[model samples]
Target chain A: MDPSQVDVPPLKDLTIDNITDNVKLINSGCPDPRLKYLLERLVQHMHDFARETRLSHNEWMTAIQFLTSVGQICTDVRQEFILLSDILGLSLLVDSIDHPKPASSTEGTVLGPFHTHDAPPEPNGTQIAHDPAGEPCLVLCTVKDTEGKPIEGVKIDIWETDSSGKYDVQYEGREAPDQRAVMTSDAEGIFWFKAIVPVPYPIPNDGPVGKLLTLLKRHCYRPSHMHFMMEKEGFDHLITALYLRGDPYETSDAVFGVKESLLIDLGKVSAGQAKTYGVKEGGKLMSYDFVLVSEKESRELREKNAMYAMKDLGLRMKLYNGLPIPEVD
Target chain B: MDPSQVDVPPLKDLTIDNITDNVKLINSGCPDPRLKYLLERLVQHMHDFARETRLSHNEWMTAIQFLTSVGQICTDVRQEFILLSDILGLSLLVDSIDHPKPASSTEGTVLGPFHTHDAPPEPNGTQIAHDPAGEPCLVLCTVKDTEGKPIEGVKIDIWETDSSGKYDVQYEGREAPDQRAVMTSDAEGIFWFKAIVPVPYPIPNDGPVGKLLTLLKRHCYRPSHMHFMMEKEGFDHLITALYLRGDPYETSDAVFGVKESLLIDLGKVSAGQAKTYGVKEGGKLMSYDFVLVSEKESRELREKNAMYAMKDLGLRMKLYNGLPIPEVD
Candidate 1:
């Protein structure tokens, strides 16, 4: 619908209090109802924010320039906007809303900006860390349904920061993946991998987001954790991370990704204990059980929140289809 | 302050209801009170927007990508974010709040992204448009205070879209400015100039902002208008534009920059009438008086709204100093 063709009661002398109403009126011509709803909500919130804060002209320009810089710094590998969202806790909120889980199922967290699709497939119990200097650790996990029936062949992509507190992708001129691997559960619905004990690390702070954190007087570190992205047929996909207990930054994970249930202790394992896990040397043991939600149940929960989920399905298709997937050599 | 050093009551198992509170809590360490207030207000609005609309992860990512593109497309001359702000009516809202005026004073509007300081200065009553093919238009204006006493030496920067509905900067490989100039009030506190009648035109629509307008099913044309930026030492700086009466886009300006008081009729004039204004041929006549608020009175109003104005003073100094002024050769 052309704006001139749309009927509007002549909008004149638009005052501060009236402009938002006029904006909503002008946007009433939007063709998509979901887009309309989303835009209306957005307008309400943003306008209210400006009015409540009594945002000055100069301050608004400062924000404009800041957001512009945040955008300009993005590349195929770096996503400053996502980092901004993470630090603001928006990323976690979105995850909680879009992927609600019952207490019986393991909770989910942010899939921090470091996940890569090129992680090499490794056999069960294989050492994922290539660096011999990193403190050795063993992860033991089983995948099962809410009813406790073991579900085999679950695809898992696990990655973590090295002891030096950085992912492989964080290094320049990176060739192959380290401290990360892709594997599947065995017949007994059990999967295990040997890797370095992950360490707490700061997010990329060389960008505007980093500057904002400094301005906020907030630290940039996430608690030490290992990331997991899991999927299996007839089950809901899960993206989560396990925070190590007693990490200094645990209570203040910069991205607000920590969940109480997701915290686990890395027990000190003696050589005899390591031998049971088929390792020759002493190492840390990280053990936990993973729970899955059936696809049908997940769909039912989404239907319960059908207002959002209905639009979400279409958005998912369009987003992934239209989005540019960065080229990885 | 370091994350480990801040005293935070162990935040665990953060749900949607509590995450916002926790975010504000974590950010409470921000040393600047004004910034803290702004961030708190911003977080409240944004979080409420998400929760109220049930924003999905896919939708959030779409916004992230869109904003990134808007930022990526900006250049030395193009400010896509400002255009975005204009179309959303945010620019106008900010102007209204920051530059509130007495009914007698000329109201300010958005400084639409076409302004350039390099506009060559012209003598009063001289022609601004270089193109001979354009329909000549004579502008007559006086700068006066609330008492109707003429004020001399008010510097005015005037610019408008050409007869082809584009700014001089819009043209590819443009060397010098046309349809724009800088001038000052004459001895009688009056200034007159000859220029082409500006035509309604679309803002830069090849960017994300344009796509958003199309998605909203709205036309992109602003009403034909001439922009004016005036500054006099003892008066409040005024940035405004005069909208022509009866323009097709008048009722639905793409940027919402129109006010009833700012609209004027461009009366047809004979060659005889044009000669009186110093134009040699028959053209259109635009006659109006611009009223300016004294600096003292403006400051009083701001002081009345001191909650914002106090911060604005510091922001003005920092914004101009820190902002990169786009260079024009």
Candidate 2:
């Protein structure tokens, strides 16, 4: 044993009951308090879960193999781990924990695996739907603060699936980006672009996560939606999506990413109105005003919510353990 | 939504508190009961762990990346996930759960990442060590049942690290096996071989698991030990190792794999006996009688223990949740 590890108590004759404590004790030597806390609680839950389930050796090996496959499948353009996290509802849970917002502000969601930094900058009203797979729609969106005041110059990166239910990145040997673009809000906090109506699509399921979903008998399709990643100075960057209200998968998005506030209805725009945007006739118009929280407000909310979340968790644990929940007063 | 999914109620407008239930509900459609049970508990613990720690976005991403790297570093011969599980004490827990035995049987330990099926078969009394880095040692062993009767023709696979604390597999472009062999017990249920004195070795640490141990201020060395995997018809197969009695890392095996029953003290053999075994004058000797449990008995013990474990776990959970623990009849 190294001299640096002398502080960690020696672990010997480990049984099911004492193993977690010994592991945590060994991990207690970490220099960072936050990291130490995370490790301790992580070991606690992992061990407890194993014991509660009385997990068998075969099951554990299966989990190991599944995880290995997930890691092996990742490439420069793909992130299978994030996909696993999303299907498990973990990605959204973490996002919610970190990005609590006011009721009026747009709720954040899972930044699915398809976003890219190379989205070409386009002028307002430029057609982003290079592929003719679906009906044309003109997106008219505005960025605002909680006070409903326009916040100009916000860079919004937008991407979505075509009618075939696949992102441009999903195609093999794809030469150019389609149905995606980066656009900036005008001085009036408004940005509009021509795009195809987004369609419901299955996440990449040829990997282990896909196999898991199939075995779980769960569909892999997410509701038709347009992804938006907005960034501007002095405000919190937002990763969100606007789901079509009438989509069949709206109520049961495979990833559990749906939030009621992010749903929007599409309206018809006449040929004359559509022509003003330089798109073909009989196009649909989608409009929404997204509210961005200031970075200061986001930080304060995160801290406050973290405290509340821990307290609430402690109370649940107390109740579950048969201990009395503390009085709020 | 597919017609088959009508049984799974739609999940809408998910909140943090309700997402777990929704995820479980969707997963309830899995046809395999055992798999369904495993997934339920897995999600329960994973979510509870995240919530209890109030796991941050940064931390979650860190975990994802860590797992990815662990997966990516693996090769045909290297199993990093097993190493991760060993360090977390999960591998031992699962092993204990699946292979419960009578008190008289030899205890089992981790089957580490280094074992290979390609170990060349060697005759009894042959020297298995091809590397000159370690001191010569004579190993004498016998296989027996709980009733004290000898069990013949037991296949024993033996392996150990050289004095430099490296396995033959650890070296790049290695051509042949060294310090490892497969031998079978004779008609008298006895097997003898000449080998090297095993020494403590750190697990492969150039990867993420190593970095994690370093960050946690934990040593990565396992106590010097000789590996053994024994098998014979109609008896339980055993995977175990014998640790040296006074190895410096005995008490703090980085993987939490040490158990008292498996420790042994080495003894020296006289020059005459060493010559009989065809080893040098100063060679050490290791001797032990291994006991095997019948397959039927092992199956029974596992079933009985599994019931007790689940019952105990249920009681603990009930108490923790403030519910009354069930009375034993």
**After superposing the true interface residues, what Cα RMSD does each candidate give?**
6.3, 4.5
Candidate number achieving the greatest lDDT relative to the actual structure: 2
Q: Write the per-residue lDDT of candidate 2 for residues B1-329, one digit (tens) a residue.
A: 35345465777777778888888888888876666766777788888777766676777889988999999988877889999999888888777766776899998888888888889888899888866767888898899999989988899999888888888889989788888899998887899998888898899999999998888888888999999999888887788899999988889898888899999988888778766777666668888899999988987786666567767665432221111222331
Stretches of candidate 1 off by over 4 Å are A1-9, A120-122, A125-127, A175-178, A268-278, A302-329, B1-9, B125-127, B131-133, B174-177, B268-278, B302-329
Tens digits of per-residue lDDT for model 2, A1-329: 36444565877788877899899888887876666767877788778877766676767888988889999998766889999999888888878877788787889998888887788999898888877658888898899988889998999999988889888888889788888899999889999998888888889988899899888888888999999999998898899999999888888787888888899888887777766777656668888999999988887777666667767665432221111222331
Q: Candidate 1 lDDT, tens digit per residue, A70-129?
A: 999987667889999898889898888777787899999988788888898888989898
Write the residue-wise lDDT of candidate 1 on B200-294 in tens digits.
Answer: 88898988999999899888888899999999999988989999989988888888998999999987776776557766565688878999999
Residue A328, model 2, lDDT: 35
- The per-model lDDT (C-alpha) reads 0.81, 0.82
What TM value does model 2 have? Answer: 0.92
Listed models, DockQ each: 0.38, 0.49
Question: Which candidate leads in DockQ?
Answer: 2
How well does each candidate reproduce the native contacts, as fnat? 0.61, 0.65
> Which pairs clash (backbone N, Cα, C closer than 3 Å) in model 1?
none
